[model samples]
Target chain A: MDSSPPYLSILGVFALLSVLAVGGGAAVLPETKALTVTHFHWLADDEFRDIYGLGQLSPGPNMLMVIAIGYWVAGYPGAALAFFGFFLPSSFICFGASRLWNRFEGSQWRLAIQRGMAPIVVGLMAAGTVSVARVAIEGWITAALALAVFGILLARKINPAYLVAVGGVVGYFFLV
Target chain B: MSEAAPAPTAPAAPAGPVPLREIFLTFLLIGATSFGGGVVAYLRNSLVRAKKWLDEDQFLEALEISQTLPGLNATNMSVIVGDRLRGPWGSVAAFLGMTLPGAAMMTALGVMYALHKDHAVVSSVLVGVGAAAVGLLASVTIQVGRKQLEHVLDLSIVAATVLMISVFHISMPIVLLVLGPIAVFIYRPHPKRIHLRRRHHGHDIKPAD
Candidate 1:
């Protein structure tokens, strides 16, 4: 690790990501993959996928995987910067908008904004799914696993954490 | 052009002052305990069902704001609910409590991952984990977009947004700038639609029990 990492760049990237994350962390997956793996070379595609899985396995928001990217790039400071940078701007926006939210409660424009953004957010999320799929799906086994998981999830209300664990076991036995 | 009077009253919560410690601990429990990625349900169970910090209407209202904003639903709800409870400090406490557990876990995982990433066992398991995540994300997207996908215009917009990002590789700002306004304009209010707000409000807010 560099003695003094480029904290500013890390901050700048995550801040931009925070604002652009309109539909949450999943919506920003492609962008995060693009910036971290392709643009910055901070991590490889496999590394990104692994870290994302780690995030999924943990409690709280899965987006917290961002700290891993920062840690790989520049140690503890990088980790802190990534966490604050990713969460702060969006939190402030949520805070301000929420405080002022009721002021426009009954306004048609507010309704319009919500209505208009709904589809767009959905679109963004679909794109995120595709992006992750691009990196994670390698062969028939992986593809089958993904499909099985999707089928199971849509069919039932089981906890996803269990599926994720089962996946690791399957991988340990078969993929290896 | 304005219609109903906009009340500037503070958020409609119970009159009793909530301690910041309680705010932090409540969110802390949710953060530490909620697994499988959907924090919204856990939030509703706690805030509305368990604690009654917010009534059903207030909870739904907060959820709408959280979804429409540019952040994770978990964190945004925490901030909005916390602010409603105890101002900025409450927001701080809630945000911290909601994130601390996950952050610590991710940090420890990161260190372990860094050390053993290249090991065949770790890599193989992660491969499966990542693949499973794709399914998880797809399920979430489909569920969230099920309503939007039914409408023709919304479907088109969804298609366009997906195309722009996945195929065209357009950045997010450009995607939002191009699609956001167009979609909003498409849904712009008609002047002749009087009392539409009331209809929308009823449709959105569930009856308070």
Candidate 2:
């Protein structure tokens, strides 16, 4: 039933995902995984995991990795499409909503909405954590690494990028 | 009027419009430096402590708007905070700065990955990186939600959300549609207990003294 050019399909998928990303990229992890891996066949599970890892190594938003996905599927054009399609719609929404929210600064429902959505956001984040873990926490070694990193982080405020790099060194010498 | 006029300290302080170049460069600095996913702390240090662009309340207000929107809180916060200081151009400037570095870096890395998919070292290292990232993502999620997870009602909603998404495999739009209003209704503003305004954003999580 696929009928469109690859670029258009890529654009359409992310553009829709951009709007549906209500609580942030993590909130939409399951859907994003489903779209890119299951629906579009853009990447395999292991490759997706690797790309997600690469995205984390970068400094800004985690989901900017979608650009990588776009690149894999359709080269430079696909990457451009993903960058524009994925970011534009939501950026516009954030831009417009921020102004409107400020304009109605004292709206009666503002607090209520913020408070109510808080738990939902938490739940979505947890779901996202689980989704990532399902793919990444494969064996005893990875599970131990993930657990160790988790405990260290919860206990203290160390920068994670360093830890991730150290893990690559560990993997290079031992896991391989 | 009581509600419209924020407390004596209006946070952003509006202190005349900031120069657009200042806005762009500062955000660009944040973009280049903020590593891992800890941009929030870096943002506070730069924008609030250093530049005095927003007071605590103003920063939290903008944070609420960022978290409530569909994009990443990082970029959304940049755009909103930028707009507060300047205007549309400010929003555009901040967003560009916030996203440009990572986008360029990822493009280069992805291109390299595409060229060499079968390199044993790359795959192995990436596997380790991916595993470590799971831990980091999990830690970030817990830290962000620690407050919301404390209460029983909020706990249940969080559980419901996780269950529906992870276990039941419900679509996001459906899940949001069904649970969003219910969550809000339970937390609906009650004027009778006017004590609600104090910790709206939970920016500082110290237990009440």
Candidate 3:
């Protein structure tokens, strides 16, 4: 059990995902789930959902929870590696591409790319929804909780932290 | 705050770059305080309304670049806006300040979860948290994708993408390879697409025009 191999795998998987995450973290959720659960078996489905929940609970980018997967596989070093693997590559891309993009100030192709990618991004997001649902919606109780939160968010401008808290309370009483 | 709000047409000064510390602190504040999600709104308030570091057009331009990139808009915006304020070092400082707090927090939480892998109560609460996340992601996708989803052709493209990935279980790269170009071509700069582009005119995605 020399642990470095899995750690490297974690870095490799997330670094690859960092670039391919075209519409941000949500767009890559299904692929992320696939690589982590289906391919690498690094996380169980439920575990993956729970870790994603941790990211959502935090204040910054929701994808930061990838740290949990790394930590689970290795240790503190793994957490550090996950952060590097996930953020660095994409940050570099944005840095370089933004510089290049400015040079194409009037390029019509830019608009076309934006228009073309938008719908496909939406579709990827829809699939992302399903990926979370598979792990989150275990039974009628969880499903109802999810639906309630969805309806509340759509209907009001309330902060979601409160909704997530409400969900925990509901689950504590009904689920456990 | 009023003093900080620059007019949209304010000229970019060739004066000394914004102090790197100021860029770091502003993003640090945003990273620490922005809650739940919708970091974009927090960013707008701080950068445009409060700090007056960037005008509305500049902020939106930075935002558009952020969204068009691959990572989370929060980090990407930090990079772009930070770079605008200073340069690569500014981007580095802002990135560190923005991500450090949340990264530290998640790391702690990850450690806690690992240590208590089978805790009955912990797992129970996590189940609910996960469910709530699903709801949040759903609303977020709908909100962001609303513009792209309204047109029939666009809607079909969206649906086809969902089916290809979710139903067919096709890997993402292949789907992007085959469909990404097709979708772009369908919306290319032909006369019909030009008309459609006009209909979608004034959208920030085509800001330079």
| Interface RMSD of the candidates, in order | 1.1, 1.4, 1.1
Q: What is the interface RMSD, in angstroms, for predicted model 1? A: 1.1
Q: What is the full ranking by lDDT, best candidate first? A: 1, 3, 2
| Distance from true location, Cα of B133 in model 1, Å | 0.5
Better of 1 and 3 by TM-score: 3
For candidate 2, give the docking quality class from DockQ.
Answer: medium
> Of 1 and 2, which scores higher on TM-score?
1
Q: Evaluated on chain B only, what are the TM-scores of all the candidate structures, in order?
A: 0.85, 0.84, 0.86
Q: Which segments of candidate 2 are over 4 A away from where they belong? A: A1-5, B1-17, B192-194, B197-209
Please tell me how candidate 3 rates in CAPRI terms.
medium
lDDT of 1 at B95: 97
TM-score of each: 0.92, 0.90, 0.93
Candidate 2 or 1, higher lDDT:
1
The DockQ for candidate 3, computed on C-alphas, is 0.78
Over 4 Å off, model 3: A1-4, B1-15, B198-209
lDDT (10s digit) by residue, model 2, range B1-209 = 13465446555565568888888888888988877776777787888777778876677677778877888878888889888777789999999998999899989988999998678898888888888888887887888687555578888999999999899988888998999999888877788533555454464332211
Q: Supply DockQ values for each candidate.
A: 0.79, 0.75, 0.78
What is candidate 1's CA lDDT for residue B195?
Answer: 57
lDDT at position A121, candidate 2: 82
RMSD of each: 6.5, 5.6, 3.4
